[model samples]
Target: MVQTVKLMKNRLAMYGLVWVLAMVAMACSSDDGDDNAGSREVKFEVTGNFTGQLNAVLITASGGGTSESINALPWSKTITYESNVPTTQISIAGAGGDPGETITVKVIVGGKEKSSTPGTATNSGTIAVAAPSYAF
Candidate 1:
């Protein structure tokens, strides 16, 4: 009888282990068909009548990366990102331009303008503009 009880206990432990493993596997599995299910088209544009070359021009790209341009007026960038984050930031900065020059930054998502901001160069010829945070 003692041997039978030991065998039963071992079987019960094995069954419990199997159940736990099954639960873990199910928990780890994804119900969504694809990990990159939803994607967004993001575009950043900078336009202005700033005279002279723009220095240190910086623009944000998808995946929180940035790209720089020099003397590139009316610059724009587009990216497609499958992001889980609810919001993304878009901005632009330039220096060494003519004083009192004007600059405008825009953030477009899915071909719709989401945010726009205007900036002017300081007396030292520096300007920075940022669009409102884009919500997906």
Candidate 2:
């Protein structure tokens, strides 16, 4: 199935990103959990700079079911952000099982802002994507 192959590719890309984020989180001693349903609190390797350059990578899930699509999210959509918390959330809008399976939250940043500086990693509510002013 062509669609299946495409889904696999997308999953791989997202996994790679999450792996990088996990390593960074370990270095900072931050919490990680599946915000949608798992309670994961991953530490992001981004320093505190509210210049509006940081963006949250929001991932909504998709699967088979009756009331599919939670949060009224479009089929597999991604949202951009401008400075927010180091953590983002991902999950199927209304799949009724759990949040997005497999490393859901990850960074869309090309590089780590902390790699260049020691004692890096910022903690602010700016990385949140569930705000009213958030872009979908």
Candidate 3:
């Protein structure tokens, strides 16, 4: 009778171990369909008929930081990030160009234009433009 009881206890322990391992395997498995589901492509652009170079250009980068560029005309920057990003911004200030020349700042997301703003150069031959912040 003692031998039979020992065999039953061993079987019970083995069953418990198997159950625990199955639970662990299920917990470690991933059920989500796509790992890149929230990924997005973002682009910032400056364009128009402004003659000279663009200055004081500020753009929001993929890592949620501002980047500056000087003497960049017809400028564009593209980055990829997750959709959880809160906001993105772009701006150009006091660009020296022909008076009355036009300039536009734009934010594009996922191949679509999210925001655009246009400005005209002042008589002093400078233009400043800023696009509205884009929210994911």
Candidate 4:
């Protein structure tokens, strides 16, 4: 009888060990796909016409509770920005050419772009803001 009881206790201990290992595996195998839950990177592509002494373009990005201004870009450049929010408002403006001499501007974000059609950069003119979708 004592031998039978010892064998039962060994079996019970083995079962407990297996149950604990199963629980650990189950806990370690859950992944909800939110690896970037805190921050994400966004890219900006700025391109425009900088002619006749206009060598720089002013780029501004604001939104997601923050604001940034890049005041001197070489008319065509890419900017990488990091943010926790997935949408940002960007703008470009310039002035240095003759009257009606235009400076076409476009901003690319999240692989999407928005252009300022007929963006006129007259002696004292500007352009509006462009908002694009982003992802994290």
Model 4, span 1-136: residue lDDT tens: 6776445444533443444334333333221235443333334444444443322222223222222333444344555544422333333433333555454445444344442333555555433223232333
Q: Is candidate 1 or candidate 4 better by TM-score?
A: 1
Model 1, poorest ten-residue lDDT window? 55-64
User: Which has the better TM-score: candidate 1, or candidate 2?
Assistant: 1
What would the per-residue lDDT of candidate 3 be over residues 1-136, giving only the tens digit for each residue?
A: 6776445444533443444334333333221234432336668788888875454333234433443544456878887755454444555655346899988878777666666889998997766675665444
Candidate number with the higher TM-score (2 or 4): 4
Error of 2 at 70 (Å): 32
TM-score of each: 0.60, 0.21, 0.60, 0.37
Better of 3 and 4 by lDDT: 3
As a whole number from 0 to 100, the lDDT of residue 97 in candidate 2 is: 21
- Best prediction by TM-score: 1
Model 4 misplaced stretches (Cα beyond 4 Å): 1-42, 50-74, 110-118, 123-136
* Residue 58 shift from truth in candidate 1, angstroms: 7.5
Report lDDT per candidate. 0.56, 0.27, 0.57, 0.38
> Evaluated with lDDT, which candidate comes out highest?
3
Across 1-136, the per-residue lDDT of candidate 2 in tens digits comes to: 6776445445534553454344334433233222332222222222232232222323222211111112221122233322433333332111112222211222322222111221212243112221111111
Ranking by lDDT: 3, 1, 4, 2
lDDT (0-100) at residue 78 of candidate 2? 33
